[model samples]
Target chain A: MNWLTWRQHRAQFLFGAATLAVITLFLVPSGLGIWHTFRSTGLAGCLAVTGRDCGDLASTFSDRYTGLQFTIPLFMILPALLGVFWGAPLVAREIEQGTHRLAWTQGLTRLRWMSTKVVTLVLATLAGAAVFAFLLSWWSRPFVAASDNRFSFGVFDLRGIVPVAYALFALAAGVAAGALIRRTVAAMGATLGAYVAVRTGIELWARPHYEAARTISYSFFGSGPHPGSGDWVLSTRTVDRAGHLLGNGQSLDFNVLHARCPDLPGPSSGFVSKAPIQACIQRLGIHLQATYQPGNRYWLFQGIESAIFVGLALGLLAFAVWWVRRKVA
Target chain B: MTTPAALTATALGKRYRGHWGLRDCSLEIPAGRISALVGPNGAGKTTLLHLATGLLAPTAGTIETLGRTPGEDPDLLPRIGFMAQDVPLYRSFRVREMLEFGRRTNPGRWDAELAQGRMDRASIDLDQRAGTLSGGQRAQVALALALAKRPELLLLDEPLAALDPLARREFLKALMEGAVDGEVTVVLSSHLLTDLERVCDHLVVLSGGRTQVAGDIEGLLEAHRVLTGPRRDVDRIEGVAAVVQQATTDRQSTLLVRTDGPIIDPAWSVHRVDLEELVLGYLGQPNATALPAPRLARTGAEVSR
Candidate 1:
């Protein structure tokens, strides 16, 4: 069974190797170039320096490599690509070609055939995703140094063990969809769609809420919440002396400002100016506050997200085995 | 102890989404005999073969091949070889790889010598991809895979469909050579009666999702005869056990009847029926029963008829 799986999937392995080589050709130069610029511009030292804010210098250096941001996000599609190309066709191709009859009747059980192919492909997917994440993490190091933020959407998933978990989920989803649908092209499409949906759905609805966001407050008119710099600020709001809620961007109206600080200013075009509002807030002892997931929790969040994806992957694979064994031909 | 049948099914039935593909089918093909499974389209012939392979499970009753239920026991698979009608092979694999696949998959039972001989006899190119091969080559490769497993019972569905007349003759000749001297029991299902008659010793006829007639060919042939006489009621004929087919002109009535004894009526002439005529006679009238044999594959040729 193992021999058959390898013989059948050798073409896919070769394609994967060639694809990795092409990606390496592109990653090596950009990574080195970014590293060189960071050193030359003195921002590399600031990555380790803790005394002062490096935001200005970091932004200037990072802006020079704007092309890096665009290209790196493209790697995010690798998981879905694995699902479509590797997972969807694994079993679908066999049934579609009517070779399941040949494979199942050759003294080996169907369960063995399914498990062998799935296990072999899964090991390969994990190894490939791990290697990819390593290169991506290495290449994006200067970006991390410049931004001091690892939780950025496109950037975060690219640099951690979560990508490996996502790869597993994608591959399993593909295989399960293939087993259920029994059509290679349709299963491939479903795998791609499901991978993207689950990934973005988790990022948008599940990740931030893994733990409650911590709150930090600052005096009005002062440099506000520099302590929340590396964290993901879900929202920033103003609170009064008594801790009454204030507008967040548009949470409060100009009428409320007029009612509280009547002598400050009148509404212009249904909006109050920020200068007077800042003065009124200072006069009232209102505070600016940020709700965020702390940057120090990066690895913890990575662990948690990886657990969710890997759990989902295992579930999908289990469902696939059950479907193949019980429901399918 | 009596030897167990190579393949047997009791009240075997399969139902698809909205209709039954096979129903109330019970048959036992004896060991060491080549059997022909004959049926019209939608007659459950392929369904019976699929049930034997355990590819499609029986919905109603049990089907046992080589004395074990397929799909329930993994060990039974290697013991029963099956050639599906379409001759589905791995299109991407080279002929060499397919043989390797058979060898690797069937581990202990695989006969590498027999496989190589089949390849050589067919003059198959080892380097060529199966997808690129001609239809004849594909069928040969399929057969080679099934045969090289050295199964005790081989179920072949439409195995000779893709071959030419000469190839068909050679194929039947090969099957005759295999089953006559070897331990393998082959059940070949095809519409070509001539080809089947050349190789098969036992017979099974399926129609309307049921077994119409099943017995040894020679015995079935012997028990049935065509009687030409004056047009009269068949029920009045004392020697005839059952009427399989009836045709009449203005003054003459010809009846094909299954008899337990010789037709001795002076008014009628009895002619021994051929294999094709016997099968067609049974098939022409779906309701005809050839007087159920003692066994599914029983040869009652020693009887008076």
Candidate 2:
């Protein structure tokens, strides 16, 4: 079985390795350029700041990280494409081409034949994912550490162990889809669709729960007293769980709001002071802050999620095996 | 007699939904016999081979290869080599790589020299990818893979359907040579009757998913006859037992008859039916019944008139 699988998929393994090497070679230089741009600019210091001002600087830093971080999404998508077209086709092509009948009639059982292919291709997918994860993580560490933006969470979350999970799930999904569909084009489309759905579902809805929760204040009002004499303070603000404002966890200062709203009457000019805006200020407490701090417990959360996907993958794989075993051409 | 039969199928039946692929098709092949499975398109020849080789499960029957049920016995798989009608070969694999894979996966001992010899005889290019090969070459490569395994029972579906006359002759010759000295039982399905007549001792003709006629080649030929004469003289014929096939016009009638004695009547002329004519008669008429054995000339000659 080992020898059969090795012979069957050696070409795919070589092609995958070559593709990974070429991508790394092409992207590493560009990645270094982004890193150099960060080191030369003073924006790196903004990452160390602990206030709303730092959040503003972090947005700027995110733009710098985008150059290198862009590869993370590409890595996530390209491997799945390859798995669908290349890995999925492994068995389908044999069956489509009529080679499976020849192999099945030989001494090897259908179960053993399919098992060899899945195991070999799975190992290859893991190796490719590992290399991609290592390179992407190593390159994007500086920028990811600086940004601290929630948007950057998608990028950082995908680069390291997350991509491995995605690739494994995609490979299994591709193989299962191919076995079920039995057509290359349909299998490829089904695999890509499933991959996108799983990635989107996990990133948008599931992974956030693994991190510290945070809430954003969507109200278009500033956190301060409204001065009388036709003065109204309007500002958009967001905050987190610690009663800290959105950009960074800092208490809102009404003195600054009053200064910005110069229309406020002199200190005693029939101004309501803090009374008029107190109701609006209390509404700020209604906003919930659940910040995702995945780094603190990366392994624990990753293990749980990986287990779930792995189980799904294995279950799908078993179904594919059974289908192939019982299938009649 | 002590040795086990190479292949056996008992009450073997296969049904897809309501359509019958094969039904009540039972056959037994003794050791070292080249059996030919002959049928027209969609006669379930390939389905029967698939069932016997364990590529497909029989819906309500048992198939035993080398004394073990094919589906339940894993060890029997390695001993039986099957080449489906749609010769399945990996497009990416070169001829050499395909043979290597066969030798590695097959439980039988690898015969590298034999494989190379067969490839050389077939004139197959070792470096060419299987997908790039021509149809005849693909068939040859498929045959080579099956032959390389040195299986106990070789079940080939339409192995010679795609080959040209020259390649077909060469492949059959190589196959016969391989089976000559071993206990190998070759059950090959082919539409080409000439090849079957040349190499096969046992012949089975399937029509409409059932075995219409199956027996030794000489026995089948001896039992059937083609009787042709004027249409008006048909009733004048005596000792006419059963008609396998009949074509009549205004003046002439050609009837394929099965009988055991001579047609002594002067009005009708008798001719011995060859394997081709017998098979054609059975295929031409679906409702043919058993006919009496034809009579042989008293001279004890091989050919009878």
Candidate 1, after superposition: displacement of residue A252 in Å? Answer: 8.1
**iRMS of each prediction:** 1.1, 1.7
Per-residue lDDT for A1-329 in model 2, tens only?
78777777677768788888898997689678767766666556654554425445556767645555455566658757756866578667776777778778877888888888888777778888888878877676666556432134456455657667667788888888888878777888888998888867876677556544433343334333211111111223445335555433344555533443455444456555664345434444423233334344555666666776677678877878888887644
By TM-score, the best candidate is 1
lDDT of 1 by residue, B1-305 (tens): 14458888899999989999999888888888889999887899888888898878889999988888988898898888888887889889999999999999998999888888878887999999999988778877888888888888888989887889877776666566555556889899987788889778889999888888888888889888999989876565667766778899989999888877877888899999999988888789887654354641242332121
Candidate 1: which stretches are off by over 4 Å?
A: A222-229, A242-259, A267-278, B1-3, B291-305
TM-score of 2: 0.80
Candidate 1: give the clashing pairs.
Answer: none
lDDT of 1 by residue, A1-329 (tens): 88888899999988987888888888898778878888988888876767667778888987788866667557989888889999999889888988877787778887888888889999999998998888889888788867767898888899878889999999999999999999999999999899989999999999989898888887766664344346777777877887778765325566777779987666664655678887887777877777888888889999999999999999999999878866676
Model 2, stretches more than 4 Å misplaced? A1-4, A26-60, A66-69, A149-153, A208-299, B1-5, B123-125, B131-137, B228-241, B251-253, B260-268, B289-305
RMSD of each: 3.5, 7.9
